[model samples]
Target: MFSGLSAFPLTPLNEKGIDEAVFVRLIERLNAAGVDSVCALGSTGSYAYLTRHERLRVAQLAVQHAGDVPVIAGIGALRTRDVLELAQDAQKAGAGGVLLAPVSYQKLSDDEVFGLFDAVTRSLSVPLCVYDNPATTHFEFSDELHGRIAQLPNVASIKIPGVPADPEAARARVDLLRALIPRHVTIGVSGDAFAATGLNAGCEAWYSVIAGLFPQIALAITRNAQAGNAREATGLSGRLAPLWALFLQYGSLRVIATAAELRGLVATPCLPLPVKSLQGEVRQRLAAILDELELA
Candidate 1:
């Protein structure tokens, strides 16, 4: 379903509300840059932070502007019913597929996790991508559990978050997923820093954050790697080392937004009250990183 660079754009906002124009521009940029797919309301989009109406608007705009690129909508929520509702809205909004992460205040058990997906799959017509993002969800998927979910009807893909700072380990993890999961299902890689390694190791796609802001660079990496120019691809990704280190230190949620803000793609950084943007020292360090990368 999702392959290559599935760009997850940052949800831009102004004091009034979500900046619709900025949202469209971001999606259009990815589409123009030839990203394989667009994932609106993904972790980078702050799906859990936005109301249903806000999330739907982002999905609608993403689908409308994506052109030939498939738009995958993130339908994650704290409860099963809410997730189901959002998934329906996403499909209705013309999203190509829906991504769901098992988010909970209370830790979810393997059976509970399976049941959540089972119920949602029963109600959905479009394919679902199991989002295994432990950083935000706090619930890790054992390979056994992911394999069980893969067997469920309508579950078409699984997103594997990479192990930052360990390229070899990340590739090994990707190898494990390909070995354990069904051959028919797609396995997409997140963690933009290590994703080049994941791609070289045989993952089908890069579900990227930087791709949202810098689709051209992201696409270059994937295209080169897929074309067997892995050394070239790795070298290109190596330029993003400083930024990746920042993401690991503070978090991509912060660093990506800060980068987007500096790039003039958005009027403000990743937003709304309560969500911290960037600070003094950190902002200074980010500036140096951006300058080194020569990103405007």
Candidate 2:
């Protein structure tokens, strides 16, 4: 379940609440694309903004509509108690695995982060993926800390941030983590732009944002890299350099939400409040890029 492309679809919202019908369509699209797994409530899914009830329903909808694709639900929360509750809810919602970022309002020490995973894993029957997304979590996981957490029961994968761009450095970074964690715990790389590099460097999975809306292109990169066609995979990723640049400038969530809107996969301003849709010239540029890349 943790060894290939995991698509993180956006949880579209309307004024009433979660746009369940649209969200289900997104999941079904991923299923038809044959993605290895569907990750609901991920950072791209705006998990942090949704209420517990909304998140539970999103997980249920994902699992229910994903058919045979394994559903990995995000169970992150600011409080451990709430995280525990959400983890249980996700399990009950039939998630095959859960992704957990160390969400916090205050800076967390390594021990506190470790304790969070320990507590959650103890109660979780489903496998847990350590979501090392420092960009949003505001807490970085030291290699040693990751090693410690990987030892816990049900720790199945570590979703590391992007690797070094240089090939040798990327491999060394992945190799160092591989040596630290148990062999069974796969290393999945986030940061969509780094997918090809990380996969070519030995990461077993790609937890992708772009894959949510454009699964076929993302799958081509994954398949090529896994088949030892490094040049082909890197070439494929390079073809979308303009899109990656946009991601760098505006953040992936906003950019992808904008793309979803342009593609008519979801309504305009599909993102939650405080996160307005991309506007003005940037949105136009995005559309042009998507057209040029044949993604639209």
Candidate 3:
């Protein structure tokens, strides 16, 4: 059903490369804090920067430390064949499922979208979660379209990131979409800040970057919200609000990397090439926010 909080941590890389000790430590912390699952090599993990080999290794590490928990490996790629290849590798590495967006070359037609799934679904032995981040893909999979995708046997979930400017609209969109999918197909909200609203809108679960940093608090919010305890959810979310705000303010993947660093879970806070590192006032603000949360 994909309920509760799931941590999606950054894939740390040192000069010597893939720091197993640090990676294992991060996964151990997430497990102890009650994270329902862990996602590896996603946007927060700088998947774009990693080679195929590194991605496989990260999946292996995640599976090794996940114990009984499910590990969803992000298998998104520009090429359809490559995406399926990674999905196959993910299953081989013992990942519970794969998360992927539509082909990134251009906005895909409905037919092309279906074809993308047609190719990738064949290789996915486990459940598949569709990623619908329009900001990244420049393609928004409408609720109607997602309903169609939900019919696929391997299609077990959907990931949507709402526009932060208009949360009400986001809730409405999520609600409309949630109503379309069958009960068995889990609807997963990806944006941390929108998770509570998504849950209230009947989303089955969520994928949270903040869960990677403060998994216990994320678990609290999800548990209370799921139980229909709005007051408890709000209070716990308030404690985690500062960290979410850092992601909004700092403006990039640094928030995830920095959060990992604050927890002493990752080897380096360095984001991959082309993405700027947090610095000066922005860095100080993040530090202050982490302090306010007592997570620094």
- After best superposition, candidate 2 residue 150: deviation in angstroms? 0.4
The best candidate in terms of TM-score: 2
Candidate 1 residue spans exceeding 4 A from truth: 163-171
lDDT of every model, 2 decimals: 0.87, 0.95, 0.76
Give per-residue lDDT, candidate 1, residue 262.
Answer: 76
The weakest ten consecutive residues by lDDT in model 1 span: 162-171
lDDT per residue as tens, model 3, 193-235:
7777666566667788878767876787888888988667757
lDDT of model 2 at position 259: 96
Measured by lDDT, the strongest candidate is 2
Provide TM-scores for the models: 0.95, 0.99, 0.91
Q: Provide C-alpha RMSD values for all models, in order.
A: 1.5, 0.6, 2.3
User: Tens digits of per-residue lDDT for model 2 on 1-296?
Assistant: 99889999999996569888999999999999999999999999999999999999999999999999999999999999999999999999999999999998999999999999999999999999999998899998999999999999999999998999887899999999999999999999999999999999999999999999999999999999999999999999999999999999899999999999999999876988888779999999999999999995
Better of 2 and 3 by TM-score: 2
lDDT of 1 at 257: 89
* Model 1: colliding residue pairs: none
TM-score (C-alpha, index-matched) for candidate 3: 0.91
